[model samples]
Every structure is written in structure tokens, then in C-alpha cells.
Target chain A: MDEFGIIATYFAPLAGDGAFGLKDDAALLPARPGQDLVITTDTITEGVDFFAFDPSADIARKALRVNLSDLAAKGAAPAHYLLNLSLPHTITPDWLAGFAAGLAQDQQEFGISLLGGDTGATDGPLTIAVTAFGFVPQGKMVRRNGARIGDAVYVTGTIGDSGGGLAIFKREKHTLNDADRNALIARYRVPQPPVGFAEGLRAIAHASVDVSDGLIADLGHVASASGVRLVVEGERVPLSQPLRTLWGDHALSRAVAAGDDYQIAFTAPPGLEGPFTQIGRVEAGEGVGLIVDGKAVNVARPGYRHF
Target chain B: MDEFGIIATYFAPLAGDGAFGLKDDAALLPARPGQDLVITTDTITEGVDFFAFDPSADIARKALRVNLSDLAAKGAAPAHYLLNLSLPHTITPDWLAGFAAGLAQDQQEFGISLLGGDTGATDGPLTIAVTAFGFVPQGKMVRRNGARIGDAVYVTGTIGDSGGGLAIFKREKHTLNDADRNALIARYRVPQPPVGFAEGLRAIAHASVDVSDGLIADLGHVASASGVRLVVEGERVPLSQPLRTLWGDHALSRAVAAGDDYQIAFTAPPGLEGPFTQIGRVEAGEGVGLIVDGKAVNVARPGYRHF
Candidate 1:
């Protein structure tokens, strides 16, 4: 089938009312008064972002979830998304079917819909890019530069499961049980970006960032942007039960620096440690420091860097 | 350099105030009250969209112009854009400099700004995807389904120069002069999407589309969407001087079926054909037809298809 047929049959059902049934040259998204739109784009390529043989459904979900994590970090409500797919001729109809199904499930789960997109043939590995838009009250977006001195640093959800999953995927040896191994891998494949807590975060977060490039690197961004230092009590950093059980002695240290945890790390005033863990404190200094056993421990590398 | 450093050094200067200096995970765009947002995305890959050795600047310009053409067709004012770049390890700092220069040139020429985007390393060929946003009056977006019977069909600029350019790029034989060859290739490399005329078109056009997948295929889209037949007077289709000089006998027919013109095709009342060539007419029928020398001409294939 041709590009048009592929879009109409497999992808059009995922489009929302504004997409014009994917027939028009562009899509219309009504501008909401008194709201600011949050926009972010991310591209994931096969071999670099995921394995070529991975399930197409998971690949689709990963592309969307990573962008969704950005919106969640900014304290915005999910609105719409545009997808750009560069596919190899080797792609099969079954693969597209699974891909569309994955997007369909997420559209329902996130209350957002496909607005418009483009698809074309590529001679290289498959690449998928998503541009997601969200809405927040005007001037109310939680940024990365608001962390003040003495602010308490907080994080939501457990960290480092995805990193453990990546180690297993690379054939690293571990005594992780079957259930724990599968769970870790699943976390890597499909990140549950904490979209549910964005609204609540707007009122409390002094500064925020979604932990994709490891907790240390992401907090480093917060520190560098806010001109304040972040001191993490490494022992207090939350970890999943499975991660704690499998990752021997250096679990907390490694997990703190390992990336792909889509949890939100933020700073808020004292006496407002709501439902998240208070892992660190904001201080008047430069760079990030980790405290372990009441001693300042040094981290060799902070997180992933794309160059 | 890491991704953040690269963005700060090169891409950050191109970002507008809404981008927050490229430090935030997401950018904010204020919604204009009483307006609707128009969104479109296009992805171009190395070796597929352009020759691998083509100037990085031209590739970047083409990527943005193609999506800008979509917004022009929809009669919307260009506002902001997000870019997603997946670069192979082979990409050099010089290449990125040229690429960013290209985007910076067009961002100023088009009066749009970079908002927020993603850049990552890829194991495959270089890929660039851009999502552009535009604004139109709340309910006045020019659509593809509003053509009326007896309306005159018009196209902006000239067609077939890009086709001639592609032919020469493929090393095809042509007796054209050197200057003409260069001009044709330039047309193919950089499309000047008629964004300035969009506001006027919004008030006068009944239906509109950008001619990307050839005049015939794109007109077929308007016809199918509008539930009407379009008959093109092939002899009347405008051609650039270089195209006319280089293309011999089957010029009109071939140009109509060649893709990537990036010109606007719209339907308007006969009295409202202001500044564009009247190439066809909308009638009470189905599909699209071409008339040459007072005789019906059959086109075996309407346009390029990616399958």
C-alpha cells in the first residue's frame, strides 16, 4: 500500500477532531484563552534509541512517553501531538498495525490525540519524532531555574529500574529474579511518565525536571539554571524493591547516575513534602554533590550525554 | 561538546524569548485569543530527500520550507517551530554550523522563531524533522473541502522548475544554458513558499493546498475532499523561463506529474483570480482530468507515491 493508504487505514483512527481526518494539509488546534501552550519535540532512532528488533508497539510508546515526560516536568496538561515517521521499506503491515495500536492506547490513557504528522520512506533505520503540545495557565509553568537556597529537593516514583533493565538488555550478568528482570525491561520499554501529578506540581514545585539524563545530570541542569547547588543525600534516594534486592552494594550510587528514569525531581519549600521523597537540599554553591554516610561522596560521571 | 553545550553555543541564539534560552525542557507559546493554531510536520532524511553531499544549509532550508508551505496553503501566519535532529556520529561540528546557519537564515526570512527541540546521536543517516505552528482566525482557516462547482483553480508561482532541476541533478541530458541549470537547481533546493499572500488567500480562497506531491496528485486531493472534479487546462499551467527553455515537447504533462513544487494551488471565484495563473476549473464530477489541445489526455500515474 501507499503512504496515504497506510495513514488512512492504520493511523487516521487515532486522530482527534482537529485533524480533519488526516486529509487536510495541516491540523487545527483551537487556541485556548488564558492558557500558555507548552511545546517539545523528541526524535528516537533505531539502534541508537532502541533495538531494531524491538516490538513496534513499544517503540511507538517510548517515542511518545519521552515527550510526555517533558510536559509532565513543566506542569502542563497534555493536549495534542504530531508524529513524523521515517520508515524503511522493510517495514511490514503487521508492524504498522502494532504501532498504531500503541498510539491508540496512549491517546486514550493521556487524554491527548494525534493532530497531524508526516510519513516518508527512508533508506536508513526507522526514526520516529513526536512534537507534543500541552496547556498550562499563563506564566505558571514550573521551570528549572526557580530553586532557591534552602529549598528541599524532592523526587517522585522510584529511580534506576530502567537503568537495571538496560544492563540486562546488554547481557550484563546479575542475580535478578525472572519477575524482577522482566519488570525492569518493561520499565525501559514503556516509561510511565508521571502525567497524573502535573497539575498538583504547579502549586508546589519551585523548580522541576524530568529525570531522563540520570538524576544527577538532570539536577545539575536545575542547579546550573537556578545558580544554586544541589546536595543529594544518596542514601535517601528512593529505589524500587527489586532494584534494592538485585543491585548489590553500589545500587544507590549507580542508580543516581544511571539515566532513563522518567521520574520528576523538583524543589519545594520546607514543610511541604507532600507525597514525594525529600532526597536532597538546595544550597548556595555550584555543581552537584552527593552525601553518603554523612560524608560528601564524589560521582565520576553524572549522566548520559548526547554529542 | 555535549548536547546542551551545542545547543547553547549554536542553537540558542536562534531561539526566541519563548524558548527560555534553551535551558527548559519545554517552551511556552501564548495562545492568541480568537485564533486557532495551525500545525504541520515534515521529516527529511539524507540520501532520500537530498543527496548526501548536498550543502547542509540547503537541506535545513528545505526541511523548514516544506512545512512552511503547508501552513501557507492553510492560510495561516507563521508563528513558531520545534526542530528534531538525529545526527549520525559522522556529522562534524562544521556540518552543524552550516545546518544551524541555514535554519537561522530562514527563521529570519520567514519571521518565525525556534521554540524548543531535541537533538540526539543516531547510528543511521542524518534525519531532521520540524513541526511548525501558525495562527488563523478562529474559524476562517482555508480548507481543502470548500471548492464549489464552476470555481476557477489557481496556482501561485511557476511549476516544473523543480522537476527540471531534479532531472539535471540525476545527470540527465539537457541542452539548457549553465545559468538556467543553476537556477532550476536552486528552485529545487530552496522553495519560497508564498506565506505573504496567505492573509489575502484566506479571504478569497474557497479551497487550497500546497503542491508537494505534484500538481495532479495535490489537485486530486482537493477534488476528493471537495467532492468535485477538477479539469486542468494543461496548456495553461505556468512554467518558469528555465523550465520552458529546458523542457521540450512533454513539458506540461511531465511537470504536472512531477513532485516538490512547493507552490500553492487554490480555488476561487472566476472574478477573484488575483495575481495567480488560472490553470483549471472545479466541476460537478469526480477525480481530476487534464485537457490538452482541446482533447482529453489520460495520465497513467497522477504523481509520486511512497510505497
Candidate 2:
């Protein structure tokens, strides 16, 4: 597909969110009566985060979806976005068409729009960076620094499916049959980001962040910001069957350490509760720890880092 | 240097525009007492735009500045920006340190702060893309479609120095000394964008755009947008002494035809005046033309296209 066609096919659906979506030089996000705007951007590269032989549509969907996950952390609804895509020379027209179609489908599903983007042919590896825009009430955007002592930490969706999925794809030499393997493989390709899940918790969550950098690492950010120790209970740590089968007892540990989860890990005061799984709680401190069987685990390394 | 230092030195100064600047998580721009917000983003890449081996500090500064130039075109000033950087492993620490220092310096100069950014290592070439934010009064943002018939076309600063300089640098045979050559190289390497010039015309110019693409090509965008013919006087085109001395008689012509000037070229009513060069005037109906010796001359191959 041509560039415009690809954009029209894929991004137009998402542009439905913007009052002046992709048609203008900039998206016209009408301020919600008495609210302010919140914006953020994230870029993902092939070799640094994924592989070249990746499923293009799935990857494209995941790229834009994670940005939404970031907004969800702020308790903001999907609005509009600017997507800048740098594609490798080897990428074909059909691939771009398919990728855009997938991205369009995600946009329609998430109720966001593609306002504008810069696309170019590159000799380097594939890269996609999306800058998302969302709006919330004047004082409602959640942040890492909002967690308080005695707050309970919650997460949407089972953690580490993405990481475990990767193992399943890599370790085909193991005991996974075709159907089980494909399901897990799909998980690796496209993360079912808890956009709705996070949205539901917004009414109850006091502070939140998307688990992009893995549970331990991202939770550490919230703890450091809020000046509290997030003591995650090992027993409450969510896990998928594939993850358990792939890494055995180390499954939950891998989930905590694995990056690119894009699930929402949030916090609320001890007495408050809502649409999330309680995996941890906050204590008066300045670091994060993992608790197992009433004993704190000696966790030195937190998780994966981009740098 | 590492990433932090580069941002500190070159980009920190230019984070704001004599106002809120980049001090907050997001720029707290006062929207005309009661107005909506308009935002946009643009990113540049090596190979696609410039070479990586070139002085990276200069590259970092221009990458950040050019994106801000887009905001200026909208009659908006810098607030905050999201930087998405893709780097090849080949970039040395010394190179990156200098780059970050340049970014920090510019951040201070431009009066913006780094709200957030995504950084990653790529097997691909070095790429830097920034999405800058700015706010406009309810109906005060100037757009490309605002040009009107009989409006005067003005250009700030000189053109061709940048494009001509690049041409001179690429020459296999050259005679200029380092100092002379450095001046020419500076135009291509570290363009002094007329961000200040934009503010001066904010109240006067009806339609404007930064001359990132050549003047003719950029003006073509306005012409197409406003549904008018933009006739630009070739001789009135500005040219630096270095460009004139380096290229002689064809200097202005080359500047008019060449792109990537980064100067502001805009249209306003004939009676409306400012400290701008009257390069041409907007005419009635649909195409862009170049005037030389009072006659229409063909302006071939408009500007640079990334695709």
C-alpha cells in the first residue's frame, strides 16, 4: 500500500477520537470543559526491544497500545496521537498495509485517533515512536509520586505472559504442541494491554504506572517517587500456565523481572478497593521489596533497563 | 557524555519562551486566559536528514530547534518536549556527552524542559525526534491555510546558506580555508533558526511556515493549502555573503530553489508590515510560481521530501 493509503486504512479509525483528528496540521483536542491535557511519548526499536521477523500487525498494535497504557495510568481516556514510524528498507508495501490495518483496528477498539505522524524509509532497523494525548479533570491525572504508606498495590491482567511467550517462541525444542505454542507466540507478538482494566481502576486507584519496565523495576519507580517500600507478595504475583511450565518455580520471578508487560500496576490506600488484583502493599520506606512466606526476599537486581 | 549531560548542555536553555518554560512536568501555558491547546511534533534522523559522523552536538541542537520552529509557525512558544532518540552502538561516550551538553544548553536557551523521552540502542542509524508542545489563544493559531489573495510574502534572514553550504561541503574539490569554510559549514551544520523572528510577526502574519523545505517548496504548501498562487521574486530572495561569495550570480537563485533553510516564510496583507523582507506576494488561485526580472520562471523540483 502507498503511504497515504496505509495511513488512511490504519490511522483513520483511531483519528475518530480527535474532534479534528488526522485531517489538520495538529489534532484539535477540545479541552473537556474544566480539564487539562496530558501527553506522553514512547519509541520502540526492533533490535533493542523485538526481532525483525516479528509479526508486523501485532507489533504495530502493541506499539500504539502501550502508549494508551501510559495514559490509562493517568486515569485518562484514549484521545489522539502522533505516530512517527521509521521502517527498514526491506519492509514491503503489503506489510505496511497490513500493519496499518492492524493499527487502525486497535485505534477503533481503544477509542483513540491517529492525528498525524512522520514516516520515512530507513536503511536501519524498524522503529516506531508514538506520542499520545489524553485529557482528564483538572486534578485527576495519577502519578508515581501519589502512592502513600499503607496503600495496597494492584495489577490488571496476569504479569509475564509476554515474557513467557517469548520463551515459548525461542524454546520450540521444548514440550509445547502447535496450538499451545501459537497462543503463547501470539502473546509475545501483541500484548492484550489492560486499557479497560486500567480505566475501571481509575475511579479507585490513587496512583499508577504502566508496567513497561517489568513489575519490580517499575514498582521501584513508584516507591522511590512516593517514598514508600512496595512489598510485593510472591504468592499474589500473577502468573500464566505457560509461564509456570516454561520457567518452573522461577516463573513468578521471571514475571517480576521481565520487561514489556504494559499492564497497569497501581496503588490505593489499605481500606480502599476495586477492579484489580492485590499483589502487594506499601510500607513506610524508600525502596521496593519482594515478600515470600512472610519473609522478605533478598532482591538486589530489580528488572530490565533500557540503558 | 551519557544522555543526561547532553540534554543538560544543549537542550535545557531553549525549553521555554520567556514564560512557563520547561520547569514543570508539562508546560503550564496560560491559554489566552480561556482558550484551548494545540500541539504537534516532528523528528529528524541521520542519513534521512543529516549524517551521524557530523558534530553530534550541532545535530542535537538543530534537531530540537527545528521541531520548535513548527510551534513558532503556530504563534506558540516552547513549553516542554518529548524526545525519542535512537542511537547506534558506534556513538562514543565523548560524542554523546557533547551532544547532551548541547541539548541542555539549548533547552535553557529555548526555555523548555524535557518532560519525558524514550531512549534506546538500535542496530540502525542514529535518529532523534522531538514532539514539542505549545498553546494558542482560542482562535489565534496561524495555519498554512490562512494565506489570502494579495497578501505579501516575507522571509526572515537569508536562505541558500544552509543548502548551498551543504552543496559546498559535498564538493570533491574546495579552496576555502578553515575559518571561511567553517562559516559556510555552520549554516549547514548549526542553522540559527529565527525563532525570535516568529514572535515578531505573530501579530502581523496571517499565514506562516518555517522554511525547513526550500522556500519555493514550503510556499507551495501554503499555496496549496490556501488555494492560491504564491509568486515569489527570485532576486528578492535573501542570500548570505558566504553563499554569494561561494556561489556567485546563481547564489540567490540556488537559495530560492534549494530547501532546508529553516527561516520563516510567511504571508500577510500588503498594508501589514514588519521587519521582514518582501520577497513576493500571494496571488489569486491555485499554484506557486517564481518571478525573476518581472517574468514567471519555472521553479523545478520544489523541496526535500523524506519519503
Candidate with the greatest DockQ versus the true structure: 1
lDDT, candidate 2, at A6: 52
Worst 10 residues of 1 chain A by lDDT: A269-278
RMSD of each: 1.3, 3.5
lDDT (C-alpha) at residue A202 in model 2: 58
lDDT of 1 by residue, B205-257 (tens): 99999999999999999999999999999888998888877877878887998
For all candidates, state DockQ relative to the true structure.
Answer: 0.82, 0.40
DockQ class, candidate 1: high
lDDT for predicted candidate 1 compared with the true structure: 0.89
Stretches of candidate 1 exceeding 4 Å from the true structure: none
The lDDT of each candidate is: 0.89, 0.72
Write model 2 residue lDDT over B30-116, tens digit each, in one string. 223445455666677786567766887888887877777777776776666777888776777788778777777787787766666
What TM-score would each prediction reach against the true structure?
A: 0.98, 0.90
